[model samples]
Target: MFDLSKEFESFYKNKVVLPNDKQNDLREKKNLNISRLKDGLNEYNEENKTDYKIINTIVQGSMAMHTVVQNDSNDYDIDVAIIFEKENLNDKGPLAVRNIVTNALKRKCENFKKEPEVKTNCVRIEYQDGYHVDFAIYRRYKKENESEYTYEHAGSEWTLRDPKAINNWFKDEIKDKGQCLRKVIRFSKMFCKSRDYWVNMPGGLIQTVLCDEKIQNSYERIDEIFYHTMVEVKNRLDNDINVYNPTDTSLSLLSTKDHEKKVENFKNKLNDKLKKLDVLFESDCDKSKAKNAWYEFFNHDYWKEDTSNEKVQKYSSCYRNTEEFIEDLVNINEQYYVTVSCNVEANGFRLQPIKKLLRSLPKGWLPHGFSIKFNVEDTNVPKPYNIWWKVRNVGEIAQKRDMIRGQIEKHVGNCKQEHSDFFGNHYVECYIIKDNVCVAIDHIDVPIE
Candidate 1:
């Protein structure tokens, strides 16, 4: 059987997992919001004299499970359960408890960019920086010789829920299956993020169910495991089957409106991904092809190779060569004739003054700045050669001030920096370096005031 386990594993480690710095940043932001919520709730309780009080706050969801993927857009969603002490909850009702938490958050975080909003189960606090926290309000109480947590729903009223139990179940599954379970879940979440139809899919709950039923081992090839899981999930959704919360038997996880359309879209997208995966794993030597397939599957730029370092290296080499070539050319072709002119209105430096080179600036004019254009007047020099510009300070003091130095494609180049500081003669040199040898050179003394 064809296998791309090594490639998938590398991709998971390099691309699927969130970087430490990003994870820390998300954690720090989440903690800050949690602190704000706690302070706000405490002040609210003291001021209002309401018996409703937050007893505990617990971090739940994919964030707590470490299954989150790196989101370059900073759109991270964190889940927190704000457990309240059960007192007069039956009389106050679930809506009342949810509203209390929402009001407290709004009062505390009045300065936040986005106002706190109420969802079916949680009070969402959205930050301007692209991260949001969902505070699920739950009332905890001892009833019938057991402690239970109750969450609110829009039309159904209070429903039995144990976020801690659900979190424990995920944790236990991860433990039993090893880190592979976590990796698989993260990959699935990333897959969802890649496609538009899957973006609104219930990622966390679906991942949990798949881990429990589909994935059998930690050592299985990731592409194989992911494909199988996708097929199974698509099948279940196509059949209109309900996925139940492992912790609460009565709670159905798939409760989105227009379930049939969602399932159809999901199946279509899943087939596309499966086809790509097939091409990816079918060949071991064509890693680039596989990477492209994966990129198409996810539709994210994070899968692309980072060429920043390569660009820096190339520019550095070109810069060094230009400098050395200019030095050599200046020494060899001292007799070469080149003309340099400056135009203030056009903001250009002209060499061999073309008609376009406006002579609007008077000599010694240095107020608005100018560009330096240079062309080789020598006919012996070959055509289509590279040109470089170098500026040096030459006065009685003879101190070399910093100047903008770069290679120009044509015979014309611009001085990126203005000559405003000194009123003296500066040497502007242009050179043509051919085959690692300086073939022609020209120099002009530019007066700057």
Candidate 2:
């Protein structure tokens, strides 16, 4: 491909990434608004004789991940997680809690052009400028005999969500690789949000996940790496549009109808744009053609200028060979999905659901003699299919004790029972095989602390 590494880098700095000055200004604005919220709530408490207290605040979304890009419309969305004690809510439902927070935000802010509105999941305050702040209200409480606190968001219902899970996942990714992946994510976001006509593009978190999965950094030039990575992402989406959350595999990021449509739109548009860039890899491609291709792709004016006269190198895409897992060996035709749930018991006394314990307990620890029973709750697949289960244990203790059991076994029924003997990040996967092809599959994590 024509070497546009210099051009890509320049465009990234001048157009794609947010400027340092703007970043600083946004930070100041965010801090000021947060302070106003806290003060307003305090005043509300004093007058109403209520004891609502702010336990913690967390910054999430693209801003926390540092993958924010410049927008043509100058519209910015800032997310802040506001945590409160469970007693403060007094058993109020989701909408009531949101209204309480919205009333608090509307108390004494002079700069607000409009009053704060209560959405389904958050309280939104819009400024005179294009910036809007969303305060996601959550309640925290410690379970009995557990050291860690459980956080649940006041959405349509009380939904369990770890406020720092996705942020920590992205931070770990950056630590393992480097800033190059962040840059690639920014470039991908710029392309996704380039045109005004394109509606319902995938949001920053989904884009970040896609880039993290498909990024190829072996190439020296940034342009070449981005091109190949985007192509790989497009190809993957062509088969399956479902995107599972990395931290919690059971949670689907595209759970809603709107989000599913958004990803479908992104996949189609990305395929069309990547086809135009195929000319760059031709034998007789030059700088002018390459510049036009990228300029049209990003729809940016900075890409119009050409500052390099470097020779074009023959583009040979290099892809890393990932180890094939057992699931990859099968012809996965996921026409349906199976729901897996676990039952927990200690000394013949039943406890809560294992899924709930997994969220509340920090390390997914169970008592010494606890037994677990995994049941296939629901499935739409036809009858007479083979049921297979696999238990994989992973941890330092499991490795040191030589107890890392990871074998697939065939079972006769829908329920499988096992005892928790060691502490590790163990998991069980269930697969439904029909006519020598996997028709449905599901897995549940069993972390032992």
Candidate 3:
């Protein structure tokens, strides 16, 4: 709820301004990336003709939105939509032109590298230098009887609209001309990693900026508000990570110099892409769920969830002996042994240590909620797909000791909905230890966004 200038003032107090040279270089790079993409589009046009002209490329993302960046910034890549007219994309015009335009890009991107190794028609066509170009074939729909413009989404095929007409459509609301409020939101999110910060900071900053009288009126331009927010955020980043943690040096035996160079290169790439907004992830990933997440691999980020490749068989197996199941569960839950033993019935047969199903749910559906879809795959299941076993819920987490933390996927067995209350919704596969006993795990870091 803090006001903008006040927020900026507090944020600024913690920031260390970059030397003019560095700032200028960074700024210049930002402009250069923009130019590169623009030039590429122009080249695309000259080489090939389309029904609709690509009027302008508007970049969306972090850099464009003006977020707080640290010394170690990454290229967010550029996201550009090919703006055209509605009438042009049809059996003959823009749709056909799209093919030619896409071909034009096959030439070269950087130093002889043809980025965007893969290209598809309707979806986004992404490339290097951190650029994600989307052909948003727009059109002003109408009949030959009357020529008026109406808008629509070009379903997975080649579609069209006018260059001026198309650009005008988006310009009205999502215009780049101005709107500075976003910068404040960016700064506050990095500080608090909360979207709520954005809503609150603007009112406060507007109040403070108005107090200056001279600059008060400029508030109408969103970019002005944005630039101001960036100025403050940049300052904070400088004072924070760079100043403290003496041991947190970028130097290493592997040529600290080389690493530093790559860091800058990466930062540049990130910044350049960021300008387009493709790199704009949900303000922050909710890894909070990961605090208690289990460490199955040296670096969990290294391995991915390959669930699509898996075909899990669901079957119910009541342990032939209840005590034996409990005993095995106790052993696995209590000890960190490499493996454990169990017995159960599945598919009219008996098997031990059942293999669970790993699902590939729709994106943003990860226990991360409705907006984030992860590509985690299933692994660690022994051969012969089905493992039969019977068990009970360890019960709700009662205290810190009860909740074990690790990423888990909901595993559903053959049990019908009426068979188990856990049927319809898959419970989080947890990796926590309660009372020194191994437990079901849930990652804490996956952001709710």
Say which candidate scores most in TM-score: 2
Give me the displacement of residue 194 in model 3, in angstroms.
11
TM-score of each: 0.61, 0.67, 0.29
- In the predicted model 2, the residue pairs found to clash are none
Q: List the residue pairs that clash in candidate 1.
A: 349-371, 349-373
Candidate 1 residue lDDT tens string, 1-449: 24557657657655777754465466666667777877777777788875555666667777666677864357788888777666645456767777777777777786676788878778898878888899887766676766644543322377667757766677567556655666667777777677544554555666567556666464367777776766666666666556677877687666765543444555667766767666654546365666677777777775565534787445433322221223212222211123334323334443323234324445533442444444444434455555566655434333233232323333344232234346555555555654433444444555555
Clash numbers, per candidate: 2, 0, 77
Q: What's the distance in Å from true for residue 155, model 2?
A: 0.5
Ranked by lDDT, top first: 2, 1, 3
Worst 10 residues of 2 by lDDT: 314-323
Candidate 2 residue lDDT tens string, 39-92: 888888899898788877777777667677896355777888888889877988
Return whichever of 2 and 3 wins on TM-score. Answer: 2
lDDT at position 147, candidate 1: 62
> How much lDDT does each candidate structure score?
0.59, 0.76, 0.31
Candidate 3 lDDT, 358-428, residue by residue in tens: 12224332231122112113323333232122222222221112322222222333121111222112222
Worst 10 residues of 1 by lDDT: 328-337
The C-alpha RMSD of each candidate to the native structure, in angstroms, is: 21.6, 18.2, 24.7
